[model samples]
Target: MTQTPDETASDAGSQLLDAALMHVPFDGWSDTAFRAAIEDTGIAPAVARGLFPRGAIDLAAAFHRRGDDAMVTALQQHDLSTMRFRDQVTLAVRLRLEAVEDKEAVRRGATLFALPMHAAEGARLVWGTADRIWTALGDTSRDINWYTKRATLSGVYSSTVLYWLGDDSLEHQATWAFLDRRIGDVMQIEKTKAQLRKAPGLSSVLKRADSLLSRVKAPKSKHSNLPGGWTVPR
Candidate 1:
């Protein structure tokens, strides 16, 4: 069987990444690690550079996305039938962290992404992870809630990861406790939102807001007409 260009590129990138991981802990996703991966994989320098144009930054992104992919696969295999929605979310986040093969690699990636030039990329990766988790957990929100849900979970996941990195408790129990508290805080906000939805004067205001936001639809995979305005009455 012949391989497509994309397939070939993907295989090359994965190979390079696998080799690069060996050096990331010491090199912190720097050019040195990328160069070493090229040498280790015996891939053509041009091809490796083509696969990762920005070098280590792209490798770091691939590493994060690979973890997300693993999390999605794990979520699909798990039985969440009896779990509360909050517990499901917590488990998804935990599964994401558990997908990592090496904590030091993550620490190095975190340091690389924390640089000013890469901060936006870091945020994008974090948001992507949150989006993946929500999608895997069967989130059907099509309104403003779609954005809000991911944004809120992004904060939770990022904070939990940072806490987990520093946590030395048995099995990172402290981090899980911290995650539960954060989720509890979010649930409390949700409770307050439900209360506001039933309030006297505030109810009307929120209703109008919800009405406007209801028209905002989630984007389809192919072509997206998101934030579509002024839907014609049926």
Candidate 2:
């Protein structure tokens, strides 16, 4: 039986995700490899390739071009040399000691990072896009789950790149190791949550109270005071 467009897109997305993780740099941001990856799932290679580098600035623009799928394609088209990866990675890490400051490249890198594992390849291409945004902003550290998210995704991207560099395994043992660490962290979090759920009501309440107190003592919002003393516009 023939597959629906959605099915074809999903399969294509999975392949792209795998390819991204493998760090197989394409000849161009919108390279033939990316197109082939998606086309292999039955989508036309030309259609798949057209989804990338659309240059849309907003979600609406992205949606008009098929949303996340289009964005991922654009990401694949990202120009690392123009972004100055060689300079930024070195300067930020060496001189400024602030590697996270290169938010743009980091964001682009993140997008590439999540491409392979996107839930529906073309469906939520935004996942990869958002991953890049977060990484670029260096705000991943600001959230409690940032470490988990960044480490896992980074592992996937980095490990895959490592594999592509010289992987002999079916899917690359190094990549598997990276994924294993990420999965382990998630499992640990789940186990902790489960244990907390089984705790006595009073204990749970105390934990909740403590959490609330911590928030209360945390730093104030950066945008606490805006024009007219309103934090949010009406």
Candidate 3:
């Protein structure tokens, strides 16, 4: 069976990521870890280099993407349709968080992204994770509302991850409490937005933003429906 380009990349990423993970705690997410991973793969150095030209950053992004992909699969076991939207969101986040057993590795990744020069990369990573979680939860939004929802969720997930990193309580009880508070904040914001939408003269601005997205980006894939389950006008 011939693998498509995406399949092949996914395969390489998985292999390299598994190998690199063993070295992360000691070597950090630097070339040292990639070299160790490459050596473990027994692949030519050039091939491993090609797989991740930017080295650790590429690997880090791939690592998160791998987790995000797995999160989608893990969510399948739960009947999200039976839950309310808030419950679905909570479960989806928990499922994603549960996928990582290497708490130290997550800590390292967080440190890596926190570098001053990597600010944009860190933002992208947060946005990507939030986008994946929302998509995995059946978000079908479009337009500016799409961006706003993901932006809101990025705040939630990123803050939760930060909180989780330092959490040592049994079962991460503190982190979950933090998550619930953040989710509550989101619900409150939604309620406020609902009231704002009721005020006159804002409809035209939102409609234009939605129209702009369709013109500039259109639909790209199953996970490409912008992001977030904003209640857009049909």
Cα deviation of 222, candidate 2, in Å: 34
lDDT of each: 0.90, 0.40, 0.80
**How would you encode candidate 1's per-residue C-alpha lDDT over 1-234 as one tens digit per residue?**
999999999999999999999999888899999999999999999998898999989999999999999999999999999999999999999999989999999999888888999999999899999999998888887666888898899999999999988989998899889999999999999999999899898989998888877776555552554432334446
**lDDT of the structure predicted as candidate 2:** 0.40
lDDT of 1: 0.90
TM-score-sorted candidate list, best first? 1, 3, 2
Residue pairs with colliding backbones in model 1 are none
lDDT of 1 at 131: 92
TM-score of 2: 0.28
Tell me the spans in candidate 2 whose CA falls farther than 4 Å from its real position: 1-27, 30-171, 201-234
Cα deviation of 225, candidate 1, in Å: 10
For 149-171, candidate 3 gives per-residue lDDT tens digits of: 78898888988988988999999
Residue lDDT tens for model 2, 1-234: 999988876565555544432322432223444544454456565555544443111211232223223333444444545654333222221221121222232344335434654324332333343345344434424333443454444444344333334445553455455445544565677679778767887677857754644332211343545211212223
By descending lDDT, how would the candidates be arranged?
1, 3, 2
Would you estimate the TM-scores of all the predictions? 0.92, 0.28, 0.82
Best by TM-score: 1
**C-alpha lDDT of residue 23 in model 1:** 95
TM-score: which is higher, 1 or 3?
1
